[model samples]
Target chain A: TQLLEQSPQFLSIQEGENLTVYCNSSSVFSSLQWYRQEPGEGPVLLVTVVTGGEVKKLKRLTFQFGDARKDSSLHITAAQPGDTGLYLCAGVKNSGGSNYKLTFGKGTLLTVNP
Target chain B: DAGITQSPRHKVTETGTPVTLRCHQTENHRYMYWYRQDPGHGLRLIHYSYGVKDTDKGEVSDGYSVSRSKTEDFLLTLESATSSQTSVYFCAIGNTGSPDTQYFGPGTRLTVL
Candidate 1:
């Protein structure tokens, strides 16, 4: 199984509608980061949640980290067409032996049509 | 957009041929990483470097290798390309350790026939 799994593999909704993307994992992480990617481009960092139970807001986006640091969620309020993209959540694990790599989820493809 | 530039933005090569993709960073960040994106696989790290000549394998390192002879350049090479190796590759740089924000390069799309 993938270390990180994102739910609602695909989502389509009308403009001004709300949506949520989830990322879950069986292992704990030191931090979790969210990124968004448009077609034919690299993913762009949206936000990073470090402490457990942390909540961050970026304009119409709200991000929350699970208390166990094993999962995260991203909520979009009144999404717009401009918000259409692939949402990915990556969890970072420090293996204690000079190894720290981020495990990425399959991603949630969201389309907000006008 | 992170002062990172990947060479050969797009390429089509044949299986059994060798290919090299370059990732150059002007930010002089200490951490550098190479990842590949596929349909069902979001982004899998192929390799990463902490400093010059210091590299480590990632989850999807098979069929791929990397070198960091210089701090600014990280190279991902397919010694003998295979059709399964075809995917869009990305390079990223970060100032600190994991969990730190990473700036990504415009990705290089490769097709192995």
Candidate 2:
């Protein structure tokens, strides 16, 4: 089974609409990260939340780590076509000294119509 | 971008052939990783290197092997290419203090026909 589960596998919305994508897990993580990927490119890190119940904002995007560190949510306000891409969430677990294992969710493919 | 590049951005090979992909970084980061991205499977780690000559397997380590002889380069090899191995591969470098924060290379698209 996938360790991390992401909701809304696919999404399509008009410009200016708001949307939220979720990443959930039954196990706790040392940190959670959000990434955005475009065609022909690798995923790019958007933000990282290290503490439980932590919230971080980047421009039009808001990211929150669950209080129990088992989940995270990414909310986009007034989304634009630029926001159209595959959003992925990964849970970070430090296996040992400085070696981290990242478990990625399937991801949410988003489309924003202009 | 982070000064990372994957050689032969795109390659097509036949099944049963051996193929090797290269990841080179100028950031001098101590940690390097290899991951595969396929439809329905966002990205899964294949292997990672903590330092030169040190490497470990990841979630999807089967059918794949890695070698890190230098701090700036990491190599992923497919002993025998299979149609199932056709996918985009990514290389990443991470900071020691914040391993979760990583920078990725453009990607290498490998088509095993």
Candidate 3:
């Protein structure tokens, strides 16, 4: 089984503080995705990185894929209270014959205090 | 938001009872997946369907079963509910062209006591 290890299971910081979350795995993945889930709701996709050493930015969030495709990072700049939620990283492996499955990390819960 | 909906957004039942969760989608996507989220376990896939009447087990499919009789509807059944099965269930639809990107439903919260 492929497992994703996420660092800093819990984080709490002031509104203007910047933070970063990391996800690492020993197995290589075809693609990696990041999601943010709020209380009482399903997770929403934040970004998908498919290439090695790739970086994508979404407003205040920046996502990067490792050079080996086995790790990813999410960095938030000047976070706000609205950015508080659970962040999840998912890795997809090609199962061949139109079958691809995703393995998710335990997730990092962030609390941005006002 | 995606055109996905889940019935019985919240449910409470006792152990040894049978429970079924429904997922309906209007996107007409070819792939659908069922996952359960628990504390410290993240979201684990229970089952997935590739097409009508075609389904496959996922990593945590031991105590769960799924049926996809039609393209728009997928059902997950717990033959005998247990306390361990109490978790938030999420249904997701995958794009045909991009299998990695999935749009999830609102989710169903099931509690078994």
For model 3, the local distance difference test gives: 0.95
Q: Write the per-residue lDDT of candidate 1 for residues A13-111, one digit (tens) a residue.
A: 999999999999998988999999999889999998999999999999999999999999999999999999999999977744545678899999999
Query: lDDT tens string, model 2, B4-113?
Result: 99998999999999999999999999999999999898899999999999999988899999999999999999999999999999999997877768899999999999
DockQ of each model against the real complex?
0.60, 0.85, 0.77
Which residue segments of model 1 deviate by more than 4 Å?
A: A97-99, B97-99
Query: For chain B alone, what TM-score does every candidate structure achieve against the true structure?
Result: 0.95, 0.97, 0.98
Measured on C-alpha atoms, candidate 2 has an lDDT of 0.94
> Ranking by lDDT, best first?
3, 2, 1
TM-score of candidate 1 against the unseen true structure: 0.95
Which of the two, 1 or 3, has more lDDT? 3
True-structure RMSD for candidate 1? 1.6
Give per-residue CA lDDT, model 2, range A1-78, as digits (tens): 339999999999999999999999999999999999998888899999989999999999999999999999999999
Candidate 2's C-alpha runs over 4 A off are none
TM-score of chain A of each: 0.94, 0.98, 0.98
Global lDDT of each candidate: 0.91, 0.94, 0.95
Q: Identify the leading candidate in terms of TM-score.
A: 3
